[model samples]
Target: MKQSSTMRLSRLVFLYAAARLAVVAGCAGAAVAGVRLFGLEVSLTWVLLVGVLAGIAVSLLALRRLRTRINDEIRIVDNRRQDPSKRPRP
Candidate 1:
């Protein structure tokens, strides 16, 4: 029932969050490496800021399918919740 579906939704959300965090970290590492490769100095704070922005952009494209699936599932769950007749029996 609702509990099972909710758990599934929670898992999807957790996966999405983890993916975003990983991308952000990867971007930060890349930023650091890129700067060093050019023999340029940059503040860590600025580099992290750039990384987060880049991560957001990349994730918006790369994670589109996953995001869509999550949204669809949320919509489904919400519909079921709003329509008591559609809700599963305990």
Candidate 2:
């Protein structure tokens, strides 16, 4: 089955959004865990700094994945656009 350009773009957008949301939630959860395990003795600044770092790491990973996915999609679109016969018959 062939995919339309709009469909591919929509899928990429959804995947990107999901990845970002997951990363943010994961960072928040980790920060909460650190607080619970380390207690109040640890400074809030340190915990938040660590959490922010983790979030940045997660965003970087997601960015890489997004880049790969976008590249693949662009390749597919280019190939489809180049092959006229592959397009659906009206």
Candidate 3:
């Protein structure tokens, strides 16, 4: 069965957002653990900076997967737009 374009787009967006949130959370947790366990004197700003950098790194790594999914959805949408017969019947 074919999936709707909106459904595909929504799924991709949701996945991307979830991945980003996970990255940020993971980084923050790690930074907190380092400070607590190692007795490292770290400021909130340093922790946040590390988190942001880690988040960007994670996002970059995941970008290819996200791009592929997005591209596939876009291609499906474009094909549907070009072919009236493939469009949903109302």
Q: Which residue ranges in model 3 land beyond 4 Å of their true spot?
A: 82-86
**Sorted on lDDT, highest at the top, how do the candidates line up?**
1, 3, 2
Q: Report RMSD (Å) for each prediction in the order shown.
A: 2.2, 3.9, 2.3
On residues 1-90, what C-alpha lDDT tens digit does candidate 3 reach at each position?
A: 976797888889788888888877888778777777988888978887887788778776867679688888888888988999998789
Over the stretch 1-90, how does candidate 1's per-residue lDDT look in tens digits?
345667778899999999988887888889888888998888878888898899888988888898998998898889989999998799
Provide TM-scores for the models: 0.88, 0.59, 0.74
lDDT of all the models against the reference? 0.86, 0.79, 0.81
Candidate that beats the other on lDDT, 1 or 2, i.e. the better one: 1
lDDT of 2 by residue, 4-90 (tens): 886987789788877877887689678978798877676767777788788878877768969688778888788888999888788
Greater TM-score among 1 and 2 belongs to 1
Stretches of candidate 1 above 4 Å error? 1-3
Q: Candidate 1 at residue 31, lDDT?
A: 87
On lDDT, the stronger of 2 and 3 is: 3
In model 3, pairs of residues that clash are: none
Identify the leading candidate in terms of TM-score. Answer: 1
